[model samples]
Target: MILPALLGLGTGLSLIVAIGAQNAFVLRQGIRRQHVLPVVLICGLTDALLEVLGVAGIGLVVERAPTLIEAIRWGGVLFLLWYAWGAVRRAMRPEALAAAQGSEASLKRTVLACLALTYLNPHVYLDTMVLMGSIGNAQGDPGRWWFALGGALASLGWFALLGYGARGLTRFFATPRSWQILEWCVAAIMVVIAARLAFGGIEV
Candidate 1:
């Protein structure tokens, strides 16, 4: 039991630690101190839902649905490419980026934006449901839930820490040069991930 719980914890923490769009949004929100709780809650809940789906045999379904998977794969690739372009454009136009330093968008708009950002990439479900679920299944039934729980906990813990901690780094990220460098790095990462997803062979 302990071993399964530890395994789940490790697996969950490892997968969620990657710098994905959700994490990026959390970081930006932390810096701005805007809609932090809602963002964190949405991310955590979304993760939990996907993790449950994964453990409930959705992973197997995804594995067998090659056409659906392929469609999602291409869609994810396109979205990443589009996001990368936006990041590059923002980096190029520092003034435009700075202009929105203090967004006054309504809470409803913020929530919706967070939801769209969280759910837009179909790969997110693939990663959590298919990949993580398959991993949990290896531990057998009783242990599987424990593993899912561990992963879900990791999602909550990591996002909360990241979103809140980034607030302290706002000073460092304030400079135009800093934004430019960060945006460029984000663009590079997005492009690389997109390429990998589009061209790399399936491992799981």
Candidate 2:
């Protein structure tokens, strides 16, 4: 059970650590200090829900649906590219510090944005359900649940820390130049991930 839990934790953390749109949004919300808890809760709950679905044999379905997988892969790639472009545009057009100060994304918008961000990306299902599920399924009966629980816990832990930690960086992100640099970095990461997804054979 311990081994299964540890494996699940490692697997869960590994996937969560990736700099994807979901994480980007979470970090952005954290920096803005708007709807932080809601954002974290939604992300963590979504992860847990997906993991449960996967453990219930949805992973096999995904594996068998190669066409669906390919479609999602391409879709994810395109979405990432599009998102990267937006980030680059923002970087280039750096928002005024005063504007940044007054602008606060509504809670409803934040929740909806996060839901769309998490659910729309097929990669989330691929990673949490298919990939993580595959590992959980190998754990044998009751142990699989333990593994899944571990993975869910990891999501909870990581997202909470990420959202909370962003508060500490608010001072640094106050400067317009800092936001520009951060946006550029976000764009670079998104583009790199998109390229790898579109053309690279390396599997997650």
Candidate 3:
């Protein structure tokens, strides 16, 4: 039981630790001290819900539906490109840290973008629903549920850390140059991810 849970924890961490669109957004919000709570909450909770459904076998149905994945792929690509453009535009301004934070993202807008980033990407589905699902189900019976729990906890813990712990770098990001660098990095990530989403095909 404990072993399965530990396995789940490690697996979940491995999946979530990667610096992708979602993490980049969360880190940016954290550094800016803007709507970090809701951002992390939505990300963590969404992952938990998706993992639960995956462990229960929705992944199989999703795997069977190529059309659904196709829709997500195009949508993700467009959305990511739009997001990347925004980052690039922001980077062009190169304002002071306080000036940059002056126009903080609204909660509603932030939440919606967070949701879009989480759900639009096909890799999220692959990582959570298919890959994590297969592993969690392999734990067998009650162990599977325990595995889900561990994974959920991992999601929550990681997002919380990413959202709050980012403040440690606040001083560094206080300078506009540093902030511009971060935004450029974020834009690059978004473009790369968008390219992959556009060109890559989902394999079950």
Candidate 4:
């Protein structure tokens, strides 16, 4: 019971702590202090929902749908590369980056990007649906629900932390150079993750 939940919590955190595309996007939005609430809410809720469905045994269905996975894979790769290009441009043009600091992106655009990052990434489905689902189910009976609860809690907590906690770096990102470096780092992460997804298959 409690043991399954504890295991779920640990596993959930371990998988999410990595600096993937979604995490990178969250960090940037956090630091920029724009659309933070919606961004975090979308991320937190989506993760929780996915974990719930996964625990309910949707993972098996997902496992059988390689075509859906392939579609998501290509969509994610294109989106990531396109996003990486935006980051690269920001990095290269420090003046624009600095000027855009005080600017806020529209709520709709932010929500769309958040949703895309959450769903389009094939690895996310693999991790939450397949891997987490299988692990939760192995706990058996009511323990699986407990496991899902733990994982959902972890997901919500981590997103809240990442999206809100990023403000602490405000002082550092005050300069254009700092912003450039940050954008470049974000671009690198997007490209790397996109490359892995494009070439590494579900093993990623």
Best of the candidates, TM-score: 4
TM-score of each: 0.86, 0.88, 0.96, 0.97
Model 2 lDDT tens row, 37-152: 99999999999989988998987787678777677777777767777887787788765643764688788877886886777566788888899898999999998999999999
Error of 2 at 109 (Å): 3.1
Question: Per-residue alpha-carbon lDDT of model 1 for 1-204, expressed as tens digits?
Answer: 777777877887888788877787788778778899999999988988898889989878877887776776777788778878988998999886666665554779778767866776566777788888988999897999988888888888888999899999899887777878878987887788788878893444
Predictions in order: lDDT: 0.81, 0.84, 0.89, 0.89
Per-residue error (Å), model 2, residue 140:
1.2
Residue-wise C-alpha lDDT for candidate 3, range 34-58, written one tens digit per residue = 9999999998998888888999999
> Between the candidate structures 2 and 4, which one is better when assessed by lDDT?
4
lDDT of 4 by residue, 137-175 (tens): 999999999998899888889988999999999899999
Report, for all candidates in order, the number of backbone clashes: 0, 0, 0, 0
In model 4, which runs have C-alpha deviations exceeding 4 angstroms? none
Off by over 4 Å in 3: 96-98
Clashing pairs in 4: none
